[model samples]
Target: MALFAVLSGLSACGLPRSGPTKGEIRAGSVEEQGDTFIVPVTAQVARATAMVPPLGFTNGFLGAGVIGSDVIRPGDVLGLTIWENVDNGLLAGPGMNSTALQEMQVDGDGFIFVPYAGRIQAAGNTPEALRRIITEKLDAQTPDPQVTVARIAGDGATVSVMGGVGGQGVYPIERPTRTLSAMLAKAGGVIIEPEIAQIVVTRGHHTGRVWLKDLYSNPQFDVALRPGDVILVEKDQRNFTAIGATGAQNRVHFETQELSAIEAIAQVGGLSTNAADPTGVFVLRDEDPATANTVLGRTDLIGPQRVAYVLDLTEPSGLFNARDFMIRDGDTVYVTEAPYTRWQKLLGALTGAAGSANSLSKAAGN
Candidate 1:
């Protein structure tokens, strides 16, 4: 009876097994004990949906009108003009001279000394406000004194632009209507492989990200610039590893731009014909350990989930919109080969048997 049972099990190999079908395999399913199975179809779908790139602005503080404000700092050269009752004439030029009747340079104490005015605070005040203050000081000595203050050297209006831009440096904010794009243009636009969507603006201790596409497309995404604002255009080239059946196995640079899964695959030279498993194409995203630990420790605030996504490209439908899957900064993509790829040696034997069977059948009929 035991021998018969063993033979029955061996014969069952040729028969169809009571398990998942081809559809189930394509849908991402694994057979478990007995008739039970574990299928991550819903999870896979959710992951694919989550992998969709964020469409709009991702960073920076953009709102109506200007927030905070730029202030004057030390080491700035101010062009001072003074009108001395039409007798002293209109004094306008660079630097301070005896005939010029104007003062320049703010002391270490943030004070500028002018003729008739002993010491005045010029730093941290706008040019217009400084003009009014200088006028009031001169008015104490002369009647109806007219004073004008212009920044000769923009050392005071300092702003730092970094990341992705061709030129990253500390530039002067000459105009009040300067926008983010203007700053980038001054820095020579973005460098190669730039993340066009991820731009970060850091002011004091606060930092925010802005999406370039949204900033240009949506009028509401415009934000006024303030002095001392550090604009950092960071590339999102996190720690992404491309492996499996690609033409080249390489790491991608993630700047302030959006990278789709298809693009990432192409960057490595597409898939290798001999080793690629089209159905097993997937991405593994590691959960941010720091964020996950913080969320687990703090229960009061709404914490993010520690989860990753796996993408599959075996389905014919997935090819239609493959670009929609945005590859995160640090993700790993693996392509597997089909299991039946190693069975090519058996094809000749099978072909010969089929031919012989057909010949025998034809001979019998004749």
Candidate 2:
């Protein structure tokens, strides 16, 4: 009877649990105390929470028209060559009929000085336009002067490319690289996996982002590049935590832009088949007031509410619901241990105690 009592007490003792049981979770959901609300994962809940915000270029970034690449700007270097009709023209050398001028840089004030042509506004004019202007300026002294302007190396109309790209530097916006996609290619493309790569374009005060893959599929996202634009290519940072009775416990990053609950579970190696309770898979997130109201079908909730969305895999529509339910960044996906798992642990403990008593009794008999 003494040995029986000891084993009974051991069985009555609290057993280790992976997480809160389904009933305990439901009981603790009190809106008055600001406790986590237990929202069952229904089709309605899935649809309501599916309204995830999309990432793409804004109107300001998309609506801007492409600028002409050949249009000269300040800081552009020009090489001018002039052929005069007269033997002794204003710019002609003693024995030469033509003159060559190299390294003529456009000043900060958008003016470039030529010996015979005087200071000319070189900025905002194409090379051809500048050539015509210079010819007209020198025509009186040089007699129908023929002028040619060639664009040399310049700092005008450039973009800074950094982060996860093959080459990171300041790239000029030329004819073949006037758009975002073209600029990315000129920078040696994204070094990371295209599916997980994110491209961010910052112009002035406004910024926009899109998936690297989306740039090709969506024409609107392939926005025209602007001067002084900063482009960054990097991996997606969005992730969720997998805990409790899952096969693995870690923060798993999103493999794509949109991640569903089913895919999130799979990424963590799925739930433990032996210990996981099929009826108690929960996704924990802090729901904003607007989203919380939509999920709970109430309006009085204010601020960010702690919400625990429960998914029962044993139900008929369980798989479908999980597939439809989107897993957001910073969410915690937890699976409760099966009820039998705790019972098994308790039974094992009691059996070990009983076996020890029997062994002690046998030793005394000897």
Candidate 3:
């Protein structure tokens, strides 16, 4: 009876569990585990995941305009010329005589003075419009007067560029709508060692931004700049940490564009084959309580928005979930030991010791 009891105790079946069972893991935990855990990604969960907190202006909402003809502005010098046919000319005889070309600067008030056309608002009006105005004024004195208004020098239509560029200064807006790439190139192009990804364009109260390379590759994203727009090129700083069973435990830098959970894991060299718990992949993120409360139902458990998101790699769909899930900055990706890992190890050790004891008892009886 004693030998039979010993043998029964050493059996591998019905191992003691010190952690959550498979059923508990599948059903999902709402028992105050301190995470905004959502199972099966229901409608509410989908809504929250889809939500992107407004960052002042929407993505790609900068001053992206199509390029067009340039407009005259204040401080611009204009070459005004007037010609007369001399038929009904009150200023000249029957012979053809053209007035000397006059170069005048647009005043502070955006007005330019002409021989016949009194100070006309040239800053807000296009060159062609100002030419017509000059022709109309000259018509009173000179019959069939021909007037031409050309921009000699641009004075005020400019954009200020700073930060990580070869040339940083007030470069004139060359076109009616100057593209971001054109503006950057006019400012002597970006520095060799500069951050080519994060570029910012601020126009009055509204601002728009896009990757420098993306602007070049996709002309649509390379938005046009307004007169007073400021372009700031800066480096990226957001990074995430991978701990517990991952090959590398150090923090890894994120890409300028959106980064997903699966990509982040790959950056840290992925989970350990022998130490990782495929079912316990947890993404601990610092979420805003007010925002999390609105998105996720339970905010009473952990007030600060520090929520753990579970990813079960054991399931085939878990990898797909991770691939679609975006990872925010300052997040922690942790993989726990398997639930049955400890129990199996303990059982092997106990069985080995039992076999040793039984062998010793038989030797003593011999």
Candidate 4:
């Protein structure tokens, strides 16, 4: 009779007499218990970090433009035009003509020496500014000398594009009103499944990322390219691991441009029939052992919580919209089965018969 009472009490407590230790529950089981106890599904409460659709750019979004606002440099040719002035003893007819025309190339020092005008700074000055400087110098020698400067060779600005593009090269900035899209267009756009948001632009020592969607949707997020700017578009890494009881028992590779938790599960062919607990889905982000130990010691716990996230998919509604949650670059998702999941169907049939037999005995006693 005492042994029977002990058996009944053990069954009521829902714990087996002897089984796995607390350390052997696996990280997945702990998450399941937390969800079941803290946030009951019957309560209709939403998970703290449920996945949602990404919000694209907003506001007065403008396109990125080319860089053309810098001073002229060496290796640039200048076309100089001196007007034919005859009234002030300047004639343009023959070798002895007073109107002498010449094209001057700036030396390494950015100085251009004219016939009558001594040394004049030509580098780091706009064409218009250079023309004004020459006019002032020639005015001292030849009265009312007219001068015009024209750029015949190189512009001092360029931008680079690489990765996931048809052609990766440095593009010369031809216009001042160039935008990010315009630059990509110049590079023939990105390849299929390109990580648009991962585009990196480096200028000098500063680096920044420009989201392609943001550049198109948000008017205020336009990233302007400058001279010596380098734009790198690299292919995003797509790989994940799946453990626990599932239909397949191996890691899978998803070639999706952007993968989510629900989509990742589908790639592995869904959960196993008899071994899967729909609500026991978790993501384990393996961290450095040193870091894990530090975090565990702070909380005075035996082991650290390396489990990044625990997602409950038991509810039909939750499973239906699981695709909205985004997964990280390299994450391990585990699917565990509930303890009752494998026994509930069998226990139901025996429980009914046992209850009927007990009721009949009580009625007979009455």
Off by over 4 Å in 3: 1-30, 33-155, 164-166, 188-196, 212-223, 235-237, 287-305, 337-366
C-alpha TM-scores of all predictions: 0.58, 0.79, 0.53, 0.52
Query: Model 1, residue 345: what's the lDDT?
Result: 20
User: Which candidate tops lDDT?
Assistant: 2
lDDT of 4 by residue, 1-366 (tens): 864564455455564222222223442343566411122222122222242234332222223443454455664556677753544444344543244344456677887776667788887888789888988877766667777776543333466788867778866554442556677777887774544335667767766665565556665555666666777766434578887656565667655555777888878888777767676676656433443344333334343245344566767666544555555556777777666653553355346657999999999999
**Which candidate do you rate higher for lDDT, 1 or 3?**
3
User: Which pairs of residues collide in candidate 4?
Assistant: 60-219, 61-218, 61-219, 63-179, 64-178, 64-179, 64-180, 65-178, 65-179, 66-178
Ranking by lDDT: 2, 3, 1, 4
Candidate 2 clashing pairs, residues 3+ apart or interchain: none
Give the range of the ten consecutive residues with the poorest summed lDDT in model 1. 32-41
Against the true structure, candidate 2 has what lDDT? 0.87
Q: What lDDT does candidate 2 reach at residue 347?
A: 75
lDDT, each prediction: 0.59, 0.87, 0.66, 0.58
Which candidate's TM-score is highest? 2
TM-score pick, better of 2 and 3 = 2
**Prediction-by-prediction clash tally:** 19, 0, 0, 10
Better of 3 and 4 by TM-score: 3
| Rank ordering of all candidates by TM-score, starting from the highest | 2, 1, 3, 4
